[model samples]
Structures are given as structure tokens and as C-alpha cells.
Target: MAIVKLSATERRRASAFFTCLILALCAWIAITLSNSYDYQVKEVLVFKNSPQKRAFHPLQSDTVTATVKGNGWQMLFSKMNEQNRIIKVDLSKLDSEAYVVVSTQLNAINAEKAVDNEIIAIAPDTLYFDFTNRSDRKVPVQLVKSVNYQQQFTQSGNIVIKPAYVRIIGPSNVIDKIKFWRTDQLTLKNINEDVNTEVNLQAPDEGNVSIYPKTVQVSIPVDEFTEKTIELPVKLVGNVDFYNVKVFPQKVKVTFTTSLNRYADIDEEFFEAQADLNLWRAYGYSSLPVKVTRLPDYCKIVNIEPHNIDFIVKK
Candidate 1:
């Protein structure tokens, strides 16, 4: 076949014709994408205004498919977004009924979502929940923390929590299972002074439990630490029979580092120095190993004199 080459004028006309065709194709795509269309999207359900009289548990998973009506532009963007939409369902009517009709709450739900993306309907449009006996229990609060203290500064005494126990009200089964609630982690770095603040407890999980006074006041005593020494008489332990046990140097010097606030509060009575007699009887040891069985809180032992003591047993 012979090749057909166009003249300069013919080439220009062909180029213009192809450009118009391309522009027309682009216009069609723009018009189509700008039109509104109905689409489906997934939404996570969150129940609010729970009935006060009944303790309830959802019968189905919180996710539901929603029919949405919006422009193609928004429809395209929704697919690209990795996050699923969330719809808050009002459960106030559960006081009189066991099921919640989500359609009735559409006006309120729409207010929570994007204005342009109108939700048409939802699959499994009605939500059902199981009811149980509502009960309230008072549970202790445990503090979770990560602390770094300044040099020579540390906690002086026991931490005080105002309202140490929080009242939890929910299903009896859930309340009975919870013995204690933990507060959110409190982080402190380079702390030199006392800490007094309100820390929130971990939020109730799954909406099955509700906590009252969600936050508690935490007071931590902080003070500069200093070394102190005290002399205390050593006592004998593990000698069941009344045997006369004499330990040499009847007393030992207890040197420790304590916070300044607790310096005057702590004394020899706060600690018990004991020599285990079992060391001699069971192992035939020449000396008895001395141990400090009890020490006050927030006090660090620096050194205990006569870690091993020479003793005589008179039976």
C-alpha cells in the first residue's frame, strides 16, 4: 500500500480536529464527576444518652453500612480516606424500648457529619441491646506513673489520693469483675518539688461501665534526701526453743538516706534488725547473717554495720 502524506494546511486541520476531540473528552469527564450520586460508606456507631435504669450491652458489632448521597468529588475522596465515618446514636429511648431505630435520629446524626455528604439510610437500621441489672460498686484507684527525680530529691512519704476509691455503676457482672481502676499514666521528669494535681482514671471500656468522679487528686511528697545514722539492738530470729543466744556487739549502726521531710519522723523503731539463727544450726556457720526485715517507706539503707555477727549458743 502507498503511504498517504498530508500537505501543511491539511496537517494543521488534523491537529486542530484532534485537539477539539481531546477537549471534548475532558469536558465529559469533568461534567460526569461533578454530578451528585448515591454511594455506600461504613460508619462506626457510638451510643449516647444511655438509659439510666437499665445496664445494656449491644447485640451486634458497632459497625454499619450507610447509604450516602453526595457529589462525585466527595464520593471519590471518601474512598481514598482510610478512616471510617462515625455516627453517634442516641439511646435515650431505650428506657421504654429494647431497640433503637437509627432513622428517627437521622437529623441529629447528620449534624455530626459533613454538611455536603447527606446520609440516606443505614443497613440493619435498627440496633438491639441486651439489658442486665444495674449495680454500683466502689473500687479502689491505683496510680500508674513514670517518674524521674532531680538529684538528691525524692518522694518523702506515701502518696495520698483524694477519694482513693471511685464509684463505678454499670452491669452487675462488669462491676463485680472490677476490683480496682487505674489512672492514666502520670509522667514526671526532673521533678524536685511536691506534686499535687488531678489525674484522670482510665475511661470506662465498651460503655458497659460508668465511673463517677472520673479524676482524683494525687499528692506526692517530695523533699531533699540526707544521710542519717542510728544505733539499734539486734534481735534473734528462728530460734524456736528458748536458747540463750548472745550476739557480740549487741547493737548495730543503721545508716540510711531519707527525705528531709521524713528525717524526724523515722527512728530505730521503724526498722527491725535480726540475726537468723538458722544460719548456725542448719549450715554450721560460724557467724549469724544479720538482716533488716522491716524498713520505713521512702528510706534507702546506706550501710548496716556488722553484716555478720559472732554469736554463742547456750542450750
Candidate 2:
């Protein structure tokens, strides 16, 4: 090579060009290293606090979302198998009140590939535990619906339930709110015979609690029958001016329909069947009075078919 001398200005220009080239090469190397091995978000770890000690209500689950950081290569690999990236925290380590930071080492992951990880904060960060045991109670059953007989009918005897009570268990604060569990409302307005129904149990005002038996079987004993005519004691009311006027058929017949259970109790002493003889009084007659009598106390009036009767009287 021939020795070439450079002027001061040209030498400075050449030095600047070399410095620029070296800086560019160092920048390229640094960028390549950063893209290849630098730390970045990868997989996230999540956990629930005090799962064994606290009672979770319905729809409560322990799983939570976590945000992870790692290298681009590691993040790409984790994203390919996203389902496997979830870290499950061991509940056995939970005790007392403390912030449990998820350990990246404990996670079932490639340590050489993982760059960074974080725990996602969730509601109820701290959990409280009471070691006291609880006792279950059997609540008495109640009727939720109105018990009514058909029109002109009456109910008799005791209403019965297959199982008189249901069992309930929960925290005392929750269970104490419940008084009596009742079955769904039943309609008996048109029912004339024994009714058997499956009724759902009521929760009352208890929160986050449930009954052992959600439903109950109820049996309503009923009967339907027609009324029979019976003679009753007669009492005269409202005197008439019909002397020597004798009324015929002093006891009038009255009929109705009711349940058989109540039919046995029916008698002539329950109702008032009467006849008016005042017409005879206007015909110059005296000592004539209307005769009214009561039927049996045990009988119920379903319908008074042809309730009135004609009475023949002579003066």
C-alpha cells in the first residue's frame, strides 16, 4: 500500500465517518440482544384468599386472571399454549392475614424462558376464619296458601303434611333469620275431594341459606255429598189475626250439599226452615203465626235446592 497523506479537514471527515459506522454497529447489536433475551411479560399468577375458612355464596369460584411479562420469544410460546399458562396457587399455604405474592419459581413453567410475572389483585383480598363448628336445625313447616272450601262448603278435621319439618344448615347469622318454611300457595276453592300436592318449600328471609328438602308433599282430605232433609224443632214468630187457623206440614224440608266428612255432623238443628201464614190473617182469622225452625248444627249448606215449600192452612 502507498502511504497517502490526508489534509487536516479530510482527516477530520474520515474520523467522523468511522465513528458513525462503529456507533451504528453497536446500536444494531444492542437491539438484537434486547429482542432476543430481554425480559417481558409472559404468564400471570392468581389465587383466592382463605378458601377453606370462608363460605362462598352461589356463583362464587376461586379462579382469577393474572398478567405476565417475559421475553418476546417466551411470550410467543406462552401465548401458543395460553391455557397452560395459568398458575394455580396452593391453598394449603394460606394462613392468618397476610398478602400472599405468587412466587414465579413455584409455577410449573420454564425458568430459563420466563422473564417476568405478576399477581392480579382481586376483591376480598384478606379472608377471615372462625373455627367454631355449626349445628343444623329442623324448621317447622307452614302452609303458604289460603285453605278455603268450595262455595257453601265447610272444612273439617286437621290438615296434614307428609313431612312436618325440613332440615337447614348454615352460619348461625344466616340460619337464625329463618322462622318456618312454608309450601307454595294451594287453591282449594273448587276442590271437593282429598287433594294431594307437591309444594316447594319457602326460604323466608334467610340469605345465602337453603332448606334440606326443597319440596314437600301435602295431603288435603276433603269430601263431597248431597244434603238430606231432617226434621227440626219449630218456633213461631210474628202473630197473625187468624183464629182457629191451623197450618199443615209444620216441619218443612230443606236440602243442600256438603263434604261427607261434615255430613256425619249434619242434623236438623243447623238451619232455619219456615213458612209465613200471615195471608190467613187478612181473611178474618186470628192466632196464626209463622213457624220457623233450625236445622242441625253439624250440617253445612251447599245449595238450598228449591229452598221454599208450599204450606196448606185452613181457618
Candidate 3:
């Protein structure tokens, strides 16, 4: 072992420096352990085990300020390492009307990792809530979506939704005003094949509302459409007080586009071509435009041959 000798003055200086460091460390620890502070831990309130036949709605506030009493070290570490601090609120067998939670009840609320700290005060010291059992109703669902189809393709059948209705429970004033439930927007482009998708429904913007089965399956039937042409008889419409009235080429060709599934259903009876006598004379034109008023919803008119018809009238 080798020993290096130092002067007495150097040794005293070194000893004094270490002694001061140790004293300062001990004083800091003592001060930290003796001091207590109010730590406001912002924690969300969690509701559990709601009463049967009685539904609870929104709470007045979700987050609460829990003022706790603990030493400086305890409070600082808690604030730094705090995960989700929740105050559990059990609503089983609760009342049906609006109620307020007192401070004494808050003392009973369970909070994890807080046993070392004493909860001295809670800001806004009261929790307000509402509950109801008869404010529920069933309403139909409305699908809201934007869909663009590929060229030459069209919808062949209705847009179908499974579980077409939803059950909603909330305040009577709010639920009664909601006649239909709308789904979230689902956008699809260049869609040529059938669409089968599950979509989420929209939740009400207002508070204290609850909805059951918030999603639905949507099926949109689509297919490639074909063109078809048929000949139909043109009939005169509107009252005719004229002495004589006659139309040339009483038959007209009707052209339209429709899905193949509906091709067989398309017939002359499904269409009507009429020339309004009153409009024909009112316009005083050489020919009257033929108007096709009725057609199957699944079909779109492509063109109508002899779009105008020549007529002769005598009065």
C-alpha cells in the first residue's frame, strides 16, 4: 500500500469541504420530509355498476381537482409518476332524479396509489348528475354517405342497413326531438361492385345521451347498366275544346339505360308520352315537345325519338 502525505492545512480544507456537503444534503432531506403541500391531481371520475331500469346520464364534470396532503417528496413524485388517477363512482341503486354528491361521499370514492396522501379537499366539492328510466325510444337509422360509381354502372337495388333502427335513452326534451339516427359519412369512389361494409353511427352532440348498437352494416347493390329502346304510343293530354285535333306519327321511340336485373321489368306501360294541347297552342310552335312524365325509378331516359310532334288543330 502506498500513502501520499499532505500538509495539515490541505487536509483541514478537504475535510471542511466534505463536512459542508454532507450537512447540506441532510438538511435538504429533513426539509423535504417535513414540508407538506396541497397537490391538485386532475383525475377523471369513473362511473360503474349503474342501476338497473334507471339510466344515468352525463356528469356535471369529468375531471376533478383532488387536493391532497403529502410531504414535498411524496407530492413531487406522485405528480411526476402519476398515471390515470380515477375516482370510482358506483351508481347501483341510485335515485332516478338529479342528485349531487357531497364531500363526505367523495371521501369514500376509491383512488389508487393515493393511500399515503390524505385527501383534504376537492374543488367544486359537489358532483351533480341526472338519471331517468322512461326517456328511451326507438328510432329509424338514416345512412349518410357519398358514393361515386364507375362509368356505365348504376345502383340496382335499395341501400340496405341491418338493424335499421336504434334505441336511444336520454332527456325527454332531447330524445323526443331526434326522429332519426344518422350514420357517419362513408365515402366510396369508382365503385362498380356491390358494397358491404360496417359503419359507425353518429353520437348526439348534446350531453347525457346514450345510444344502443351504435353501428350498422350497409349493403349497396350495384351493377353494370345496359341501354334499351322501345316504341310507345303518344297520347294527347289536357282538355281539348277545339273542333278537330290530330297528331302525325302518333308513335314515338323511347330509349333508356337501366341495370340488367331490371331490363325485363321495363315496358311501354312503365312509360307515358303526352302532348299537352294547351301548351302546344300557347307556344304557337310548328311542333310540340313530347314530354315523358312517368318512368321506372331505376331507369334513366337516354333519348326520345321525335322529341317534338307535329299536330293540326281547328277551332
Candidate 4:
């Protein structure tokens, strides 16, 4: 193929067409860069540089409307870059409750995307905060756990927690309301043996509040149990001297379940079966209900054999 050379008149026309296109693009950009525009960024983050010794709690809104004035291009760029709208204030200068007047400083805000544009104004130019003395408190820790035991298994003794108390420090307003710190929810299913584990504690929602020793050791003792039955002599209760009371079948089978660890420690003497003497006098009933008034804490009563026993009273 051969190239087609254009005439002088044709070349001039082509050049003028290209020149006009370039001129139009440049004019558009120039206009966009020179025209001023207003932009409002909602929820502009107001970071606080608080003093290490004093904790400053912002009782009011921490966000502000950053209304900035700049060229159309800069405004549009800032709108797209949400991070550039954030500004930080120093709270170390505060002595007590005060209103801090904050002015937008281009150089200090968003140093990475520093722009030459000017800040028209910032809404709620003043920020208010309450500064209180900071101190630490020791609060007891509570475990939030659910244990579903397998058949014939029961928990024995108390649940032990290492470092039962934690240190919490924050503003007095918040710390005073805190009675105890709680551990994260822990659930064990079909557990048949002792459980020893470390669990994390829930963190305080307040930004200024902090807790030391975020985790604690939890130990739960579990043991297998079996039902045991023993015959016990019944004793009369209530005004026994008024009437001579005697109960037929003086012995009652006490059916109970006990953890294996404490099975040997339990004895028939530890149990006290009793029959109410008042019932014999009130309704003059021939039989009275037998109850095991006292038993070991580790033992769970399954049934009181021969629930009712015959009784005879003689005046």
C-alpha cells in the first residue's frame, strides 16, 4: 500500500481541528480548577490527643461537619477521599470542663493528602468534654459458663477461678457503675471430667476504660455419681414431751446420688430422718411423712423410701 499525502489546505484544516479539541479540553480543566465549591463531610472524625495521666470523656458528639471551600477539582477529590476529612485535637491542655474552639488547619489535617485549599468553616466549632480524675479499682470477676453433664455425672465442689479479681481504671462516672467484670460465654457439652481452661473477659465499651488481666483460669471439678440406699432410724420433731410418740418401721431407706469422690465420706449417720409429732396431735393421723432434714451437700436426694411411716401416740 502507498501513503496518501495531503495538500497544504487539507493539512491546515486537520491542524485547526486538532488545535480546537486541545483548546476545549484545557479550558474545561481551567474553569473547573478556578471555580470555588462548598463541601460538607458528615461524621468527620475528631481524634483526641488526650493526656496520659488524665482521662477525658467526650460527653457530647465526637463527630463534626467539616465545611470546606476549595476549587471544584479539590472539593471533588476530597469528597472521594473520606480519610482526608479527619482532624485531631489536643486534649492535654484542658484543666477541667471547657469548650474548645477548633479551627481547621490544612497543614495539620491529613498531612499525607495535604492540599492548598482553604477551610471555609467547621460546624460546631466548639467541642465540649468532661475531664475527671482517673483511678483504678479492683473488681471481682464472674464466670459465664454452661455445663451440660452426661448421665451419672455431676459437678463437685465450687468452681475455682484464678485471679478472681481484675483491675479496672477509668473515669469515676463509668467505673462506679461497674460492679463486676464477666468472662466470655463458655459452654461445655456432655462433659464427664474436670474442665480446666483459660477464658477471656469482656472488654468495657467505654473507650477510656481499660481492664488489667484480660483472661483468667477457670477450673470446674466433675465426677461420676451412683445412687446409694441406706436405712435410717426416724426421730420425732415438735413437742414430743406433750405426747409419747412412736413410729412403726423405725428405719427408712434413704435413696440418694453422690459423687464418687465423696461416696466414701458419706455414712448413714450423716443422715437424720424425722417425722413431725405435730401431725399426730393435730389430725391424729396414724402415719406421718418421713423427711431427711439434713444431708451432705454433695448428695442429691433421689427418693425417700417408704415416704410415709406409721406412728402411734399414747397420752
Instruction: Name the candidate that leads on lDDT.
Output: 1
Stretches of candidate 3 exceeding 4 Å from the true structure: 1-63, 66-89, 93-97, 102-122, 129-133, 234-251, 272-293, 308-315
Candidate 2 global Cα RMSD: 18.4
lDDT of 2 by residue, 132-162 (tens): 2343688898977776666544444456776
Clashes by residue pair, model 4: none
lDDT of 4 at 251: 91
Q: What are the candidates' C-alpha RMSDs? A: 4.0, 18.4, 7.6, 8.9
Model 2: residue 93 alpha-carbon error in angstroms: 11
Could you tally the backbone clashes for each prediction? 0, 24, 0, 0
Q: Best TM-score goes to which candidate? A: 1
Comparing candidate 2 with candidate 4, which one achieves the higher TM-score?
A: 4
TM-score of each: 0.82, 0.36, 0.64, 0.54
After aligning candidate 1 to the native by TM-score, how far in Å is the CA of 150 from where it should be?
2.6
Relative to the true structure, candidate 1 has a C-alpha RMSD (angstroms) of: 4.0
Tens digits of per-residue lDDT for model 4, 105-191: 434554433556656566777777666778779999999988899999988767889899999988887888889999999899999
Q: Which residues of candidate 2, in runs, are more than 4 Å off? A: 1-133, 147-157, 172-179, 187-189, 225-258, 265-315
**Model 3 Cα lDDT, one tens digit per residue, 54-123:** 6556656777788877888777677565564667765653665455553666556644445577667766
